[model samples]
Target: MIEYFDRGAIVTSSLCAEVMKKMRNEIRKKRQGKLEKVLLFHQDNASAHRSAIAVAAIRDAGFEILKHSPYSLSLAPSNFFLFPRLKENVKEQRFEDNAAVVAAVQEFLGAQDEEFFKKIILSYKKFILKVYYNKCDYVEK
Candidate 1:
C-alpha cells in the first residue's frame, strides 16, 4: 500500500486514477474478492483528487469518497498518527538514497500489526465523533 513517487513528480488526475485502480486491486485481494462492507475512501481535496477522471476512477473502484473540509488536519489520521510515528522512527537517521529511505518506511509499516491498524481506525472514529459533537467546528488536537 506504500506508493513512492519520483522526486518533484506532479500528481496528475491520471496518476491519481491509476493509483486508485491499483489500490482497488489491492483491497480486493486483501478481502479475498468478497467486499461485503462498504469501502469509504478518504483523501484531501487536492485538485487531482477532485478531478472528473479521479472521481470516475474512485466510483469504478467501488469506493465512496468521504467528505473532507479543506485544511482539516484534525480529520487526517496520517498527520496525527502514522506520519508522526514514522518520523519518530526515522528521525536523526541518514539514508543512502531514496531506496534506503523507502526500505526504512517499508520496515516500519511492515512492523505494524492488525491491532495497530485497528487502533488507527478507532482513533479516526473518535475524531469523527469529536467533530460531530463540536458541531463541525475545528477539532482540538
Candidate 2:
C-alpha cells in the first residue's frame, strides 16, 4: 500500500487514478479466486479523491467508494490511527530532503507488524459503529 511521489510531483487526480489502477491490481492478486468479494474503498473528500477521474477509475476497478463525511473526520482510520503514530515517529526528526523524509516514513511504516494494522482496522470498525449509533454526529474521543 506504499506509493511514493517523485521529488516535485503533485498528487493530482490523474496520479490518483493511476494509483487506483495499481491498487486494484494488487487487490486482485491478493484475492486470487475470491472475485465475489466486493472492494470497499474509503478515501477522504479531498479534491483529488473526489475528482471525476478518480471516481471513474474507482468504478473501473469495481471498487465501492465509501464517502468521507465531514462529521466523520473523527472516525477516519487515517486520522484516528495511522497519522498519529506516523507523526509521533517522525516528530523532531530532521531530514535533508524530500527523499530523506520519504525514507524515514518508509522505515517507520516497515517497522509496524501485522498486529498494528489489524488493530487499526479494528479500532476503525468500532469508531464507525459509534458514529452510526450517534446518528452521524461527531463522537467524543
Candidate 3:
C-alpha cells in the first residue's frame, strides 16, 4: 500500500508509529488474520524509524527489523531497484499537484506483479552475500 504524507510534512516519531500500525493492519488483512510467518521488516535508519515510539510500535506488531547500516545504498532495495524503475516510468512527466504525483506512483506500484517483488527479494539475498563477502563495503550495481 502506498501512503502519502502531506506536502512539507515531517515524518515524526508519532507518524512513523502510526504508519507501522497501519502497515501491520494491512498485512493482517491481506493474510486473512493468519500471520503464520514471522514478519521481517527492512527500512532505512531514519531518525523516526529508530525513535522509541516507532520501535515500540514495530515490536508491538511483532515485526523483526532487519539490521541496516547508515547511508548504505547497497542495503536499500528502493535505491537499486524500485526508484530507478519508477523514475524511468515517470521521467519527463509533469504533475499538476501532489495528488497527481501520488496517483502516478500508485499506478506504477500497482502495475508490478508478484514476480517483480519476488525477484527483488531474491536479489536482496545476493546483495547481502555480496556485502558480506566485501566486508560490508559498498556493493555497486
Candidate 4:
C-alpha cells in the first residue's frame, strides 16, 4: 500500500501473474521504459518482502523498496479507499477488462478535487498519531 506508482496497478501472483506479465508487455509498448527508470516498492515486515526470492526479484528489477513507512493491519489505502471502490465498480459492471478498470479508476481520480485530496492527506498525520496511542494502550479489539 505504501508503494503506489503512477504506472502500475497492484496485483497478486497466483491469479494475476500472467495477466500482469501480458499487461507489462503492452505497457512497455505504450509507455516504453517510462516506468523502468525508477520504481517504488513499499512492503511491511511480511515474509514475502523479507524472503530471498522476493528480495531478489525486486533487486533484479531495480525497484527501490521504501521499507520504513509505518504499517498496520487496520490502516491501508486498499482497505480504506481502492478496494471498496473496485468492488462497487465491479458490481455495477459485472466484470471489466483491466484497461476498463483503469479507465474507471481514472474517472474516479478525475472526480476528486484537490481540496478533497488535501483533506485526506492532512488526516494522515492524525491517523498515524491515533494509532500510536491505540498501540501504546492495550485496548480490546
Q: Assess each prediction's global lDDT (C-alpha) against the native.
A: 0.84, 0.83, 0.82, 0.52
Which candidate achieves the best lDDT against the true structure?
1
For model 4, how does the per-residue alpha-carbon lDDT over 1-141 read when each residue is reduced to its tens digit? 112334464444322334334444554677875775665544445554556666656655455654433445534534544456557755757334666667766777678689866766556446545655776332222
Residues 59-94 of candidate 1 have per-residue lDDT tens digits of: 999998777755465566677768888999999999
Deviation in Å, model 2, residue 119 alpha carbon: 0.3
Q: What's the lDDT for candidate 1?
A: 0.84
How many clashing residue pairs appear in each of the predictions shown? 0, 0, 0, 0
TM-score of each: 0.89, 0.86, 0.86, 0.45
lDDT of 2: 0.83
Top-TM-score candidate index: 1
Q: After superposition, how far is residue 41 of candidate 1 from its true place, in Å?
A: 0.8
lDDT of 2 by residue, 22-139 (tens): 9989988988878896777777767888899999999999999765656765655687789999999889988899889888988988999999999988888787777767776777
Candidate 3 stretches greater than 4 Å from native: 132-138
Q: Identify the superior model by lDDT, candidate 1 or candidate 3.
A: 1
Checking candidate 1 for backbone clashes, the offending pairs are none
By TM-score rank, best first, the candidates go: 1, 3, 2, 4
